[model samples]
Target chain A: MNADEDAWERGSGVRVVPPVQPRKLAKVPFVEMADGRLQGVVSSGSDIARVYVSSITAGTHGFNCSTNNNRPCGGLGGSSPCKHLRSLVDEAVLQYGRERVARYLQIEVGEDDHLMEGLEGTRESAPAAVVFSRFLRHLAYLELPVTTEPVAEMHWFPATRAVI
Target chain B: MLGVQLAQLHDGDRPGVAEALDLVAGFDDALVHGFARLGEERAAALTALAGAVAASPLGPAVSEAADKVAAGSIGEEHLTALAGARTALLGAVHDALLDRLDTALGRTRAAWEESASTAAPADNLLSGSRSWLHELGITGWRGVDHDLVSSSGQTLEALLAEPRLRRLAVLLDGLAAELRASCPIATMARLPVRRWADLWTRAVLLSQPGARPAASVEPVTGRLLVLGADVHEHGTAVQVQVHGVLEPAGGAPTRLVRASVAAAKVDTIVGPAVWRLLAGHPVLLTALAERRSLDLADMPLSSSGDLAWQDDKATVGAPADPFATARLQLANANAPAVPPLERHPIRISEPVLLEDYETDGDRWTLDGHSIRVDLDRLPASGPLTPELVAASSACIGLVRWDAGGWRVQPLAVQATVKRKPVEAHTGDWAQGPTDPKVVKAEAKAGDAVAVLRERAGRLLRE
Candidate 1:
């Protein structure tokens, strides 16, 4: 299928695999990598990773990603598929070839699972930058003079999806 | 004293009679209204009297009478005229006369005021009298020529000697006393007095100390601080360096030795020890112990003196025992009479035969019979050249001793390990993007926040 069809399928919550091998191209890790526009490093040893891989499209090494405001999208090893993670995977596959990419992808998945558990615990602990930004948003509303009226309403992506 | 002299004067014949009556009316009006307008009344009375004398029928009679009074050629008629007219008009005339009398009296008072300002020759005789006049609301004085009036016309001073002046004086004295008691400094400039007696009373009262203002403050300007520390091993005294802003106590900026530890000492001060103290130093324990307490003016460092390298951190050795002598002199006929040894007794020992040796981790153990050089006596290797001796005599007094292969008292033993000051760089990150790669990689990690700093350039701040 074309790219749009694959995106639609993915959006519909069904995983879609790319069709052609493109064997001569750069080898990428395949721990069920989802496609997001972010780039960053993911480490299995330190259990630290940068997400937002699509942001890496802006530069060779750099990646820009929304952390406190935007939800993690897709790319490397695809849990939230941000730009940084996509760049890390793309760079890893390019540098190390397919076999090493697969091994590292396994490690990345294990690390992602552990990190998700840690994140769950951390949710009940001190607030993350994401939660802090939310708090700041709430505070911003409260701090606005009572006389002010909202000029526009904001809607998240899935929540703003049109009804059939 | 004649009975006829006591008779009333003829109103029509009284000198300046209308003006005198006017003054009496004004005075009574002033009394009723409080003394707020007394100055205006005095001016009015004086002006009216001057006008009346120039225009009234009694004008020439008053002149002739005034001339008689001036010439001291007063008669019984003059005395009778004054006594008979001792009505309200006469009373006003009496007061006007007293007012003129005060003008003359003021000359003497003005002199007393000048004298009081000098803070010298501390007595005045007219103190309580004027204050008494002030209290009784009798603050006017205008005396006519008593001799011309043929009235036992008394001067203002003489009038105050009357029993009435006494009552007023007493009442005023009480007020003056209260003022002198509570507000001496404020009143010091303007206490009123009209007589020699008052001057004397003021002089006595001021001498009582309560009337004198005390010193307002004891100011503290600069402090002498010493910052010296010991090198425990050699016991070679190192003086402290002083530093800080020195402010003069009151007026001019004073020069003083400050901030260095050595600037706080006594006789041991290198420069002839004669330094001028810009300010005094508080006696402190470190000052007393180190003998560093010296006045700011006397800082030896101000003059050309030997500049010793202070705060040398290399001095590290066991504290010297007061009883032990590090060097000793030796004399022998066979060996040339030698100077004192400079090598440390702890660092070196006499030549010895090596018997056994073993290595244990970082430490090495060796056994040998060695010739013991008495630490209290001259160092055994001391008979060396002056240059070598100088090079070997470490200010720290620690020395290394070699016996065959083994050396004693390693020079690098650690003593106090002072923390090196951690250098921290603080400044706004260079203007541009908040990207970390933009900064010198070797530089420390930038603060996670503060990424959005912008350059202000040369814009004038509000």
Candidate 2:
């Protein structure tokens, strides 16, 4: 747990800079189904730094995570990074320090640039408006909640009992 | 040839042309005769004043009479008096020519009516066609070659039947009034009497000698209704006309033909044969008339008013049964069984999902995380139950059972539900379906809450 020993950071013996506003981890669980993949809901609380982490990890590493071997985003194959994965990374980085964030992202994903290159290609290829929209959506997804009650609440409703 | 000869003689100045020309000259002579009517002394003085009087030894008396007539004060005795010796001779010739004017005008008008009947209704009755030449006969002589008749002796007899033509002749006659005293010749020369008179005679002869063919008439059968008449006949096919009555099967019907008998008249009647034909085959005619329309429904009526009554008659056509037709159609049709009602597709242009829903008696709640509602107050029937109501806001609701009918539900409702948040846990364990909103908010609150329970459960474990 010692920062220097863990190759995290050697404190100058002065003081570690505490985050002005430390971020919370995403509450939604990421499922990989029967296939060797990863998928999850995005929680609120993640920000740009988390988005950056998620982008690098999922996009560049080509971590085969979707339900099927679905690439890019959602069920459709595309160059842009998946909104859910971006949200996940954003949640992780916001929760942990930069070193820990890097270590965890590397563990979660083998390499970081393969899918990210595709994402970068998508960003370069898409219109500025589209890229901006995707970016904002990804940021929004990062900020979504990942807790049990919230999930249940999101899905909750009276059982649709149709009267004849 | 006569026109050519007359043209050559006229000045073609032929003596006849001059003589015919004399008609006008003589007219002038008669005008001058006025100078002779006054006393010899005054007539001589006026004749000397204008030089219209003849310069012969006997001219004084003629000049005197001419002056009297010109003064408009001549007595009957003065008119009876001749101007010297030549007065009698010129007077006689003028009388003869003036007599021809009536014959001429009458002939022209008669010819015009004949031509007019065949031409447009409004062509000039006086000037159109050969009537113009007939009119010219009185004003100037063209040696028209046709027999010339005298106006005086002509006695409007020839023109009596045509009052308008006679009136025209009288009008033309008035134009040559100067000749009345001297010889009526001047009026004849200026009038349209000659030319029209000749053409009229010809038209009359042509008209009188001819007989028109009688119109065809035959007795007809079946219903008949004359458009504008009290006349109605049944089982008769006589060519009906406004004038003539056709002979009925037994005897010739009363002669109503005289009621409307004008030469070359045209009449019309909606004949009986056509009616019989329609009655005989009503179905075919009706079908033919309606064939072009798209309606596939059966014919509306039978030949007989009642189907039962029709069946009694053998000639009545067979009735078309709708069910039989439908069965035959089904036999020929090739189509798959209609899909079950549940699978029947319902399209939604706008979809809204309720994140949460709950009901406590009357109060309703939607998604717990998002908090939308279905309804609130209980109706007379009962409060809305989540299980009883399926969708909201124009949502398609299909009955779970096969025979049930599907419906649409409205989102507008009076309802509300409670909302709460769940705490976050940073652990190496998976979480079940959690409230998406709470998870999002808790995750955003701080670092320890950052670990995703769902991701840990699915991805890392996998």
Candidate 3:
């Protein structure tokens, strides 16, 4: 069993599922796993899973996956998106609606890229920003309306949000 | 004596008759001194008098007496004739002096009557008295009086000795005494004696025939707002800024009035009433402003200082502690157990947040506006408290304008809290109720990992 699978097994029996609502995403505990990846724990009754998502890039498009039963679907480094990750993205769409979510993602991703050099690869130091960015991207992909115009500048996001 | 008789002839209507008499007395002195010495100077003095009385009844008699005296034909008859001529000549000069005085006095009285009838109350008194005193020219009071005596060429004793002038002086003295008793001397002392004399002259003129009553000044009516107030030490006085909206009787547009009352008249005049009015009890100020008069006939207002609104008639027996009386019956029932005399209300407006406040010894310095108020003098019942101090430091409140500074009232304080942004990883983040044991274990492991990371970094550097 892989580390992701082991982690899921250890937390499964004692897991407490959060309410299945978009607003409940704010209460979920997320941790930074690497420079561009974030991990979140999702539970259904007595079954628990660990979902991971990567930061968006111009060409790579990023990855999303989750552990099932006592094992990761492929591995911790899997590239394919998972049903659990899709569920979270659907929740984000329900919470923020289509247009706002898209704007939020555009602003967040733009700001992260701008500050990436100064961050010095210290993702763990800003776990909140990583989790927020992932949720924001999920909302953008699922709920945003299709538009021909390119995203504009990101000034609405507060400076404190970027600090984290 | 002849000058006095001349003055009495017309009931002292003539001005400067006494001064003319004084000049006659000087001539008598010269004659007596010249005769006692018996020299050529005496002959010269007699000859000058002979020429001066040439047109009078004694002219020929004095000229013949002078010839005998000049030829060394000294005898009792010649001497007696010369003395008699001198007396007759003095009487003739007195008559001529009275003629001039009559014309001057008529013109003066006419001018004074015109000015007095139309003058403002204070101006009427001042100008009328100044006219009379200028004519009398009494001296020996001091300062300005000395200058007047020197300028007018008269002595105090000579002016007082004249029965007619003495009577006028008595009348002026009575007026001065009345003013001194009714108003503070300190205020009057600020003016020159000539001004004071003018005030007394007006008083005397008012008592004379055809004198108009003190100018019927229209009392001001308005709403008075106290912009600021300050209480002096030991509750002796209070200084205040009064903002009023005065509406005239004939439906004139309302006008805003700003006036500052000095510390001298604060307690006795309108300060206490204004202070109380600003403290949210408007009974006294409202009554005074609305009625356009304050009937202090029964009130024990201080009679020591000059009132700011002297033009307004204040009848005796008005309410003395109007503010305190109103406050006691209504708002501040649990006020400090101090004598009413000790209470001094200071008005304040425009509450602003205080950034900070501190007390050092007996002085309290409030931040934000940087006001320093006397710790002991802050309004009673609103003494400094920890809550007030804390709120002052945290927020803004209304401060009162003092004489030249600012004062803070405890009751006028307001506190505000600042809003802050939410920080990450600070509060509970797990969605549902979690197992306590698991949570504790996770927290310990997290701490251990942080320690391990720090140790690894230090080791690598070494």
TM-score of chain B of each: 0.16, 0.15, 0.20
Q: Kindly list the per-residue Cα lDDT of model 1 for residues B208-267, writing each as its tens digit.
A: 211322112222332232212111000001122221112233544322222322211111
* Separate DockQ for every predicted complex: 0.01, 0.02, 0.00
Chain B TM-score (model 1 vs. true structure): 0.16
Winner of 1 and 3 under TM-score: 3
Ranking by DockQ: 2, 1, 3
TM for candidate 3 is 0.17
**In Å, what is the interface RMSD of model 3?**
42.5
Predictions: Cα RMSD each? 43.4, 52.7, 42.1
In the range B224-262, model 2's lDDT, one tens digit per residue, is 111110111111011111111111223322111111101
Q: Per-residue lDDT for B230 in model 3?
A: 19
Worst 10 residues of 3 chain B by lDDT: B423-432
Q: For residues B1-462, what per-residue lDDT tens digits would candidate 3 score against the true structure?
A: 022322332343235434433332333433323333345755676676666667877678778877776676644445545544444443443334333333322211111011124223333333444443433322112222222322322222232233223223333433332232222223332222222322222323332323332212223433232211212211112222222233334555433222322221111111112132122223323432322223321111111111134323332223223222222221211111111111111212222223335544323443212344323222221222333344343322233332223343332223332543211110011121133653453343233212322333432233
Which residue runs of candidate 1 sit more than 4 Å off their true CA positions? A1-67, A76-130, A134-164, B1-462
lDDT by residue (tens digit), candidate 3, A1-164: 56534332222011111111112332222221223232343333233223333232212234344332233334323344444444444444343343333332332334324322211221111233344443332222112111111010000000010000
Q: What is candidate 2's CAPRI-style docking category based on DockQ?
A: incorrect
